[model samples]
Target: MSPLTTSSRRRILFVGEAVTLAHVVRPVVLARALDPARYEAVLACDGRYLKLFGELPFAWRPIETIPTVKFLDNLAKGRPVYTAETLRAYVRDDLALIEAVQPDLVVGDFRISLGVSARVAGVPYFTITNAYWGPYSQLPFPLPEHPMTKVFGVGVSQALFNLARPLVFALHTLPLNRVRREYGFPSLGTDLREIYTHADQVLYADIPGFIPTAPLPPHHCWLGPVLWSPEIKPPDWWDAVPEGRPIIYVALGSSGENERALPIILQGLADLPVTVIAATAGQPLGIKPPVNAYVADFLPGAEAAARAALVICNGGSLATQQALAAGAPVLGIASNMDQHLNMLCLERAGVGARLRVGPLTAKQVRKMTERLLGDAGCRQAAGRLRETLRDWDTGQVFAARIAIQGGDGQTTATQP
Candidate 1:
């Protein structure tokens, strides 16, 4: 088909889970990058994300599917937990949606079940995930901890993960593989481990600074971070931010991590000579901010980063990338594996520092924040990295690649 042919306006389906805003926001930005004349996009997600995509220029399809396993509870209990029924339900719903839409291409943002459905439907599919999930993850860095937890924690964790890997695979594949067999779709292979490898493309939604490029399978593409801008109006007090002191933007994403960390952050910033903009995100901690702090339920991250001197966050990729884009240094207090990895990248890139959750203290957070704000070198380094990232123009680069790939229906070789 020619690039300008009617078939070039390929119908695309995007599936996202509303467990977090990252999944919703990333796809919206990519959907916006496609030319209206060249793509007809439809989004499928839970009801919570309905309003999120309502403002976007695309068809919205609501699917009642719970997308994530409750890993947080499992982690806290130091046990492996699997939600088999949830996975099956999601697969069923997603397959129904695929049958209805009949999209030429389907894209999933962190929703692996959607990829399975697309495969069953014989349609090409893509997924956006962190590169750390790939074999390139380097973690378990040295740190002071309880002697027992320090000496045995890593080994125990690794052992448990290895032991549970097959069980986890079976929990998901039992249902999906059964459906594939019933439909005469080729069984995903003898060892069901390959079930996770269904996508035609696996786009790593992280920037180079976070996950440096390395040799990988041909199906993988490091698409950098997807930059998103929300349309929410800033609070009236936004214009009243104090002057002469550096402005620090503090947010813990939208999943209530702020509830635990916000008060500590407030206590840390109490005596500092800086203006703190804390995003409560409608999850209050019952602590009022000090004199130099401005607290809001929500603020558009891009707008806040544009005026920030520094950013304090839970090391979410979206927040960190937005701050880096605005040339702001970061002080990340990470509470999860992914957050820890992203913070490591920021520190290596000379744009930020990290405080792991186990041993984290208000004093250490304050010290790091103050040091980052006071150091001229940190700001200069962040500015340089920001310039380099701007040169990448991540959205435009990915958009052009999509256009090229969709110009003809023929599948091309995937990027490594």
Candidate 2:
């Protein structure tokens, strides 16, 4: 165990890679939940989403991440996200922040640089990630909409992807492994799962039993979903949603393929009897909504999900978790691997359906929405999961996990 500061509080430094909003938002939600009295938390992240947050309870440090557009493009192309040079720079920044904070424990959300920096700094590191990314996971890997999928049809593309999947994942690990060697550490091998989970402790941000996996090691633990919604006011049309017709809530999130799919969703649901509520995750939709649809740049997501009969999204964990927490069935039009993996778990759980974004049609969206809205079994599954989610006290669970390292005292909040 690492030593606490003179103040006797366990200093925890949280680093989030702002490559996407979900990465930054997950850490912020967890950092806010810690008991300020028992733990001293300092958040180091890119300033892109800082304005979306309210006044933070703990200290804040500015850090740098690759541009979101570049990250997304690389993922879309199925290429290595970080170059060796980019990771080297990330190590420099991470070490500087670690030295400044002098934290006893480090918690990171998708900031892969810390796999090297935290070990170099001799601190206990815990990483927040999804269960599907774990080596123990039994989830199937579906071919994402990459170059191969376009050049060849999905049937042939999927076959090619399966044969090349191991090599592709190995390529993504090369940059991180190169940086580890620079830090005088052994290479983490060619397995991308090992690279993502190379920390002292691995914390999964998911519901237990949702994703099938082999028996986990003692160091790996489920932290549950770190749910968060923007604290913004609802649109002028929030209360006017009629009760006679079913309500459908659609959100593509910040990193979701929103620009391509939102317009089709609006047009497809236009002729239906239901009312449509959509949040653009702050992007300009450029397209007009149907008379039955109310589109906004942002909305308080939790309330919207609770009010909706069905939730349509990009099948990422953040939005899907929101819908599950509200007892709303999901209709995920997934584009990337992460979103596809998440939707697969939801499908197995019987609370949602998955549609490929590559061949998505407004007709398909309307058909799935109609099916989920009428599926009583799906609704019951969501409601049961919602009750389970409500019972998970994420803040308390987190505090308990790290308390043994230092600051082993009663967990109490000071309203940060």
Candidate 3:
């Protein structure tokens, strides 16, 4: 077969932070989708998702990240997830990887250390992030789950949050700025968005209409949703899932809000006319689901989302994107800024409903679920968004950007 050779090849290393499956899986999807004949694809990531890596034919190696619990705790406390010590450790690991791969270009998903090491190694670096995190994003910054919200009600808390968000973003940027200065690179300024997005090229895994961003800079582009679902066998219950009633799919995912959300949601859906299909994402709900519900450790969320009438999740972009991709409206119980931002965009598009994680109740859940279930307008909006996304091939866009950054493959061919 001659290994399906190409005229010129570049070593493209994908560094994925493994605090959650999303970070790791996003890069894995891209690495596998690259034309291997034109690029030597390598995924250097922690094995938090070792189960999800089997079919990736590219080369791979281990890269450690902080414990997921610790990362979640930081988010819960409204503190920076990565500290100087952790990021310093990450830089050491990242440098070792860059040296090992000798990659022509490195693509990272939330792998912040690459901002320093990729430059030190003189390699081209690209970052994949959500559009809402970009400076040009127009989504309203709702008050995330913060202490301020508890102290002063939603209105006052939101007012204070709007005034203090820049400072908060600045505070989050300190660790990376300190690390960059220590390595002789210029500070990335006060905007944490710049710090988080420091790269030779920046790609947003979102659509312009759904998230509604201002005109992006030349280096930044919307790569659309780099969507991937776990390749797990559906459970026995999947085959016989009832088609007699409206289906509601519930998934909290691994977004640090699993304490009581699933149980509460299940309790709320107990007597509804709908049949609920739920996914725990490998977390156990300490309470049993109602007779009207079915549970799985993980499901092909995209498939289940398409089958259901409404998709309920922790309001992160991953699930909401899946739902929208399937033409299903969303019911989001959002906690952190990321989830809140995603839900806000859905609300703007009129395809979803949002409930605060802190103030959420089973009654609110039931009411919103009923409303979203019956709203033909919401379904129309989701279907419209689905049509917009139907033609976007994120993998193709990602590959084209790599070709541009690799100088149309000419530079790689000339390399010694």
Candidate 4:
């Protein structure tokens, strides 16, 4: 087939959650992978991610909408909370965005409501999630903390997770149902748990060690990690890192929980010997780094990871993966369900360690950092994972799959 004659472009819409840069970053990589002649991609996310997407060539539509809401009661009590009203608003806005875009295929990165909206609109929908979120997922191991919350000591966390799973599903569904009725869309009859299981394609971004899945649905695809690069230029100081010492990069994703946890992290890493480069990302914790630490509002994760000896973070998947790709071990202090789960996966893979935020102290941080730096095992394991990552072209692979599904025909295009 002639190249020009075989290339076909299809309009694609990406609905991302602006709660963190990871959500936006995943889609951006996928967009870059897409063939310009075979796909015209537009991103729908909040204004905060605009700068993150500014350097991309594709057109962007800012959707000043919330695709999910944390329950205030949950936040106040330091527990998982869900509200019907919040879900309703999220679904409503998501539906509106879908209607406005009306693309051939809709891609949702952890934005649950968008899948439902696409389904209702009779559009093909795809989503990326960890295997932990899969229907048959059972926690493979114990949580580092919260032993009391465990059920049988054999995956007790998993058991309790199973126990509360129904109620949590209801919490997500009630609001979506309310919005569906309000918007004149037919009720799905199923709850949120079942709703998540209904996507036209469900891509699990995690590797096998963390979440072991068997006999999954035909729509399920495990595409591994989708690595990303930020468009923002690194600060002038980035070029000046000391030549001999290994660098340690730290950044928390844009989440309220992360903002609250930053002080604890700053206090923990204060006396570490490694050269630390911290990306504040607009969250100020009122702590100054030592002369060895480089603080900036943002820097490209890919670049930082390439130069780092280790990475300290709130367990954002994209950041962690980038570090691992660069043969750097990670120390993760996570604050939310997804972040905690992502950290657990990394730990299970033997590439990182997780520290609980509650009862966190400088002593524990110092100990963890010392262990990671002093021992060569962590770095060796990270290097091995990096080799595996280097073997796969995740962005191009995922984009090719999408192009095939959308019937766009450019299966061999080189991804950016």
Candidate 5:
């Protein structure tokens, strides 16, 4: 296809930091939502998930990211995911891409290097993140599934974590600040959230009721939850799952780390009268399945979430959002801070409960699963959120927000 004249179409480039599918899928959802006649879209990211996007119509490029296990291990070890070295490399790639694309706007999903690269390149920058991390948002520090949590127990671990969180945030902020300083940009202080979300525009893919923030600026707007699921053939066992019983769908998601949790979850639910549909997400679990359980390597999440009486996941927002969208409450077995934060909102909205993944037991899993199964209140709360999502066109909202900022690629804070 021939390039359109610059005057005829606005160019937008979406850069993803694909440590997992969520980061990559979020931006892909936005990019696919734009009107091709009005915008020229390009996606640049680590090449790992190119097929996951599955035949993109837009221009695509490969950019290296730190290995997935490296990123996951950092979360597991309670260390910062990015190092100064990593950020420096990212900045270099961001600059190279910006120069090549000459995009009118750059939208990034967790491509933190854009905190500096976009400003230096004179391109308008937009960062997609959860609203809970917004500076103005109200948040609670909860202990995640970790070695410390197991050692100290949930209550004491949370108390100590709440006290040390500021220092922890500061420690994580250093790599970004150090990278920014190296590139002649001043430090964004010590708050990692602030550093993460700093941009010409910050778009949150969450709804207001689920995560209300201190009044946001016009430049910062809610884009709702930009959700996606790959189209794939249903598993052969899919037809065998009886529709007569209450269905429970369990998927720990790609990032949830504890493959060991699968057998425990299956065993915990073994005695239940419900049919359990479980996705190992390509992880192999050695446990023999109960007659009531169906296991697959993957399943279309939205379908499973919609059909289930309840959803159990890693407590990350993507799966939680899908479940809530389907009016199904979730049982979040959270292992990291991100999952913990998502569960915090789910619990607040009265639609979900959080279980620390570190100390997770078959008995505890059974208890929470039973609670969600029997409680009408959880389904009621999920129904309310489901209704709210009905009016949300997340991709369209993201596109329109960027379009309104098109003239000079600058945003005005909701001025009357």
Candidate 6:
């Protein structure tokens, strides 16, 4: 493929790994937010969440992604999610897509194969990722729940984890490095951070200063949070949710073990002087909803979050950002490392609290919910953070980056 000339609008391709909804949603949202006149956007991903997006302005192409069950199981077992052979297959598919789309630049959210595919195709690549995964992150890594954590207590497991985390991270980088070596590229080194961020440009979908990091490379910059919500309509009970009491919105998301957690959440808040609105993410709710709680399979997250006095979720960036975007305090019931890392930042920012899923209890949820709902400080912090998020035009920043990369060298892109 020839280089794109200045006279033509740049064609940008976005590839999202469909292992989780957040991965697919981030890229789709960014693609939707682009300046159509200056950029031709194409999105390629598995069709798991496409129904939620409704009609799109840009072109959509189908692609293969590993099963979500396999991905989550790997995370739970502390195993690397991808294998050398799996990534090798992904590279072939990505290259085929690159040939078909012929994009001037490629943007990926958790589509790790692009690290090898884009480079081999001689295309510039940009990655959308959280700051906590970057090399410069100053936040501590809490040991995720693994077999070791269950065998040994958290205290002992955490200590062992601290001692072995470096080795474990290196091991996780092997599959990607092996694929890179096959493509005649040098190893991205043993650091998983470097492997994940290996691209021509890296965009962090997070608030500035919310997570401390060292000085970033010029190509690495904040694009702010790419906030997106499903297009699902509110349940019939939405209007009927009582107005006088505090409203607590609950959505544990897909990555965590929601089956066990949802019951605890409902039980904890059963007698509280609040209204509970929970989204079950389409999973069957084995137990009945409490009198004060309303249950649904899906909810428009942004609107649901905006109306809540408190937001509870899986502690992943997408849900937490949704709550913080609405100026609502959060109580994260986190299970995975990604969730833990994200929740750590929110906790440090004083806008939220994090509780592990392993030992979650009704009493703990009630205590945390009462504390967050009653504490003026949590709401105040969330309000301030909401203002900060408002100042960051994520779409404009991303468009400006594309403009500069396409030789326009502009700080902002004009939108229609």
TM-scores of the models, in the given order? 0.84, 0.95, 0.94, 0.83, 0.95, 0.97
Clashes of each: 0, 0, 0, 1, 0, 0
In model 5, the Cα lDDT at residue 154 comes to 81
Summarize candidate 2's per-residue lDDT along 1-416 as a digit string, tens digits. 35654367778899999988889888889888887776778999999888778788889999999999899899999989999999999999999999988888889989998988887787778888999999899987988878777789899999999999999999999999888888788888888999888776788899789999999986677889878888788999989878789999999887777888888888889889999999987877878789999888888999999999999999999999999999999999888899999999999999999888878888988888888888999999999999999998877777767864444422211101
Q: After aligning candidate 4 to the native by TM-score, how far in Å is the CA of 234 from where it should be?
A: 2.4
**Superposed Cα deviation of residue 324, candidate 3 (Å):** 0.9
Better model by lDDT: candidate 1 vs candidate 2 = 2
> 4 or 6, which is superior by lDDT?
6
Question: How well is each residue in 263-321 modelled by candidate 5, as lDDT tens digits?
Answer: 88889999988999988878887888888999888888889988999999999988999
RMSD in Å for candidate 5, one decimal? 3.0
Clashing pairs in 3: none
| Cα shift from native, residue 355, model 1 (Å) | 1.3
| Number of the candidate with higher lDDT, 2 or 6 | 6
Query: How does each model score on lDDT?
Result: 0.70, 0.86, 0.84, 0.68, 0.84, 0.89
lDDT of 4: 0.68
Candidate that would win on lDDT: 6
1-416 per-residue lDDT for model 1 (tens digits): 11223555778788877667787777777887777887888988776645533377888888765433354544334332334455567778888887888777778876656645665666777877777655444533332122334456755745655666556445545655665555455656533334444577777776653666457675666787677656677889998897677888888876426766788888888898888887887787678778888888778788898889998887878788888889999888776556766777888878899876555678988899878988898899999878876777667766655654566644532211
> lDDT score, residue 81, model 4?
37
lDDT for predicted candidate 3 compared with the true structure: 0.84
Q: In model 3, where do residues sit more than 4 Å from their true spots?
A: 1-7, 408-416
Candidate 4 lDDT, 1-416, residue by residue in tens? 12222345677888777756677777777877777877789888776767776666887887654432443224324343334565555667777876787677778886766645665566677787777767767654334334344335425655775676567556656655656566565665544544554467777776555465566765677777788766788899878888577677887756434455666666666776678788877766576666677888888878888888878887767778888889989888765556677777778777899776645677887799888888687789899999888887777667755756655432222210
**Where is model 5 more than 4 Å wrong at Cα?**
1-6, 412-416
Tens-place lDDT per residue, model 6, 1-416, is 64655787889999999999999999989998887887899999999888888888999999999999999889988889999999999999999999999998899999889988888888878899999999999989998878787789899999999999999899899999999888888888898999888877889999779999999877789999878888877888889889799999999987867899999999999999999999999888889899999999999999999999999999999999999999999999998999999999999989999888998999999999999998899999999999898788999999877867667533211110
Q: Ten consecutive residues with minimal summed lDDT in candidate 3?
A: 407-416
Ranking by TM-score: 6, 2, 5, 3, 1, 4
Clashing pairs in 5: none
